[model samples]
Every structure is written in structure tokens, then in C-alpha cells.
Target: MNHNIIFQKIETVDLADVAAIEQQCYPNPWPIKTMQDCLDADYQCLKGLTELSPEIRCYAFMMIGHEEAHLLKITVHPAHRKKGLAQAMLHRLTLIARINHARKIWLEVRTSNDEAIRFYRRAGFEIKGKRRNYYRYKDHNGKQIKEDALVMCYSLI
Candidate 1:
């Protein structure tokens, strides 16, 4: 783990690298255009850079509402995993949510993604509910499959 990881606001130009990491992190990564939409008015995108290079090693995309913040996605570059980058991004997002007057932070993770679920729990998020067939993707055979999602929440107030 590098102790010099730096977190900053994500820019449109950074999307390509962000998208690359997205593909590696999920079975169904958001399309590049979809990730572009995350730059809309209500969303906040944060990325982590290390050692003065312009490359982003991790990112957190979030949507902010009147009283809550929703974590749309978070990912760590494959080479940067186990380096606490995700945790750093999560903490930065939490502070951003609080600064925006949000009372809570919310997110959904694929039920099959136990590692992420554990990570979120460690970040103080608790399972609040479940959504059936919340995510759709193709399995190894290329057949469409749907997966349940675990809804989780964290208090910011």
C-alpha cells in the first residue's frame, strides 16, 4: 500500500482509464457513455492518483440528492487492490456527502459479490434490504442472467 495516494475530483478526460478499471472490476461494467452520464449535475466523481502520475488507480461515482447520497459505483485498479485505495475513496465520499448536507449514504451491491459486501460493512454500511433481479448481465455462455442486489446504507448524520 502506498502511503502517498491522493484523492481528487474526477474529470471527463479521466473516464477512459476509469472505464478500463470498471471493465476489470465487474461482470457488467457500465458503458463508457453511461459513466459519462455520471458527470451530470447531481453526481460527484472522485478518483485516486498515486506517486504524481496522472493515472487514476481507483474511483467512486456518487449521486447526491436532497438528503441522501447514493454510491453508484466504486472500483480499484487491479494493480492497486489490497492497498486500501477503495477505503480511502469511501472515506472521501463520506466526507463529501456530509459536506453536502446528506443524512445518509446508500448503495447496492450484487449479492454474489461477497467481497464488496464485506468491504462496505467494514466501512460502516449495513444491509438495509434487497432488490430482486436488480442487475442483469451475460453469464459465461453469453446468456442473459439477473442477480439480486443487496441494498446497504450508512449514516452521515
Candidate 2:
């Protein structure tokens, strides 16, 4: 990652940019209200940006509690990808989870997202189990599709 890239807790001012990244990255992005709710719930949220601007190039949402951390979402904008931003965000989240005394960090990924699966695996996240039909979305033809979610975990201790 570039040394100029900075990571900080996301603020309200960053919502629009964060929403745009979500829309661009996911076919079924989380609603703005949901993001707001995460903020309201005081979830662990971080935005990654360059020092030259306030625009968020990447972000992550994780909830830390009960001896574990659950990664709710993570994304790096398409234009800013391939520059190690996503990995940096993941590393930051892992560090935060460890600092909070979490025994493990967990995330669920859509089984079809092969790139993300590989990325998590490379980061030492193991496939622990599956959530059957955990995700539902529509295809280009407007047909509904149901997909499984793979539960992955990284041990912190």
C-alpha cells in the first residue's frame, strides 16, 4: 500500500462516496439506511483514503463483541483496486479485532465470489462452514437466484 494512503474511522461526510463504491462493487449493495444503521449501532467502520483528498477509496465494516469480530463488509473502488487497498483494509480490521481481544475474526462471503474467496484464503481465513441459501439476488434475466454463503474465520490467538 502507498504510504500516503490513510485509514480512519468513517464519518457522516463520507457516506455518499462510500455508498457509490458499494453500488459499483456489488450487484446487491446494502441500502444507505443500512449503512446509517451501522453507524448508529456504533459498529467498527473504517474508511481508507489518500492524503490528497477526503474521498474514500476503500472501507470496511466490522462488529466486535462476544470474543469475536464479524466482518460485515469490505470494498475497494474499482478504479482504486489492484493497489493493495483491499488487503490493507483487511489487515487493519484484523489488527483492530486483535486489539479488542477478539479470539477470532469471521466473515461470510458469497460462494460465487471466487476472487474474494481466494483473497480471504490468502489472508489465512479458513472455510469453516456454509450457510445454505444465505444470499438471494436477481440475475440479468430478472430471474431470482439463491446462493450459499461460506463462513470463513481467522484465528487471532
Candidate 3:
């Protein structure tokens, strides 16, 4: 764990680094256009960078509504995993949600991602429901497959 890591808003400069991490973190990572879309609107996104490096180590993308925030994605570089960066990012996001008058936060994680499930559970998110075949999978031949998604929610109020 790097004690000198800093968390900040995701800027255009951080997108390349984030894309690299996103590609490695998810089987069907968001495309550059989607990332741009997330950045172009009234959404909330944050990046984690190391004091010694110019690259982003982790990133979280969230959407805020009237009284709830949807955590769209959270990813940490494989090299920097298990170092508490994701938890730190989540903490910051929760604070931001609170300041925005949000009473709850929601997110969906893949049923196969046990590590993320544990992390979210430890971060105070509870399993609320499930979405069937909510995630897309691609075969070597570019065929699309589907997987179940687990819905998790965190109450801030």
C-alpha cells in the first residue's frame, strides 16, 4: 500500500491511464466513447494517483440523482490491488454523496466477482437484489455471452 497515494477528480489527463486499468479489470470494459460520455455530463468520477507516478492507479464513476447515487464502475489497477485504494475511493465517494443530499448509494457487481462482493460488503453495501444476465461476455470469436449481476446498495441515511 502506498501511503502517499492521492485521490482527485478524474480529468481528461487521467483517461488514458484509466482506460488501461479498465481494460485489465473487466472482461467487457467500457469503451472510450462511454468513458467520454461519463465525463461529459453531470456525473461524478474520481481518480487515484500515486505521488511518484503520473498514471492513475484507480478510478470510480458514479451518477447522482435526486436522493440516490449510482456507482457505475470502480476499478483498481492489478498491480495496485489489495492495497485499500478502492475502499478509500469509496469513502470519498460516500462523502460526496452525503454532501449532495443523497440518502443511499446503489451499484451492481458481477456474481462472479467475489473479491468485489467482499469489498462492497465491507464498505457497508448490502445485497438488495439480482439482475439476470446483466453483464455481457465475449468469446474469442467475438460472440456475446451473458452473466448475472448482483445488485448492492448502501444506505447513507
Q: Rate the local accuracy (lDDT) of all candidates.
A: 0.88, 0.89, 0.88
Candidate 3 achieves a global lDDT of: 0.88
**Which one wins on lDDT?**
2
Put down candidate 3 lDDT per residue, 1-157, tens digits, no spaces: 3467788888776777788877788888887778888889958888888778878888899999999999999888898888888888888889999999999999999999999999999989999999999997795579988989999999998
Task: Give one digit per residue, the lDDT tens place, for model 1 in 1-157.
Answer: 3468888888788888888888788899888888778776648888889767988888888999989999998888888788888888888888889999999999999999988999999889999999999999996689999999999999986
The global Cα lDDT (0 to 1) of model 1 is 0.88
- Where model 3 places Cα greater than 4 Å from the true spot, the runs are 1-3
Total clashes, candidate 2? 0
Judge candidate 2 against the unseen true structure and give its global Cα lDDT, from 0 to 1: 0.89
Candidate 1: where is the Cα deviation over 4 Å? Answer: 1-3
Candidate 1 vs. true structure, TM-score: 0.93
Estimate TM-scores for all models. Answer: 0.93, 0.94, 0.93
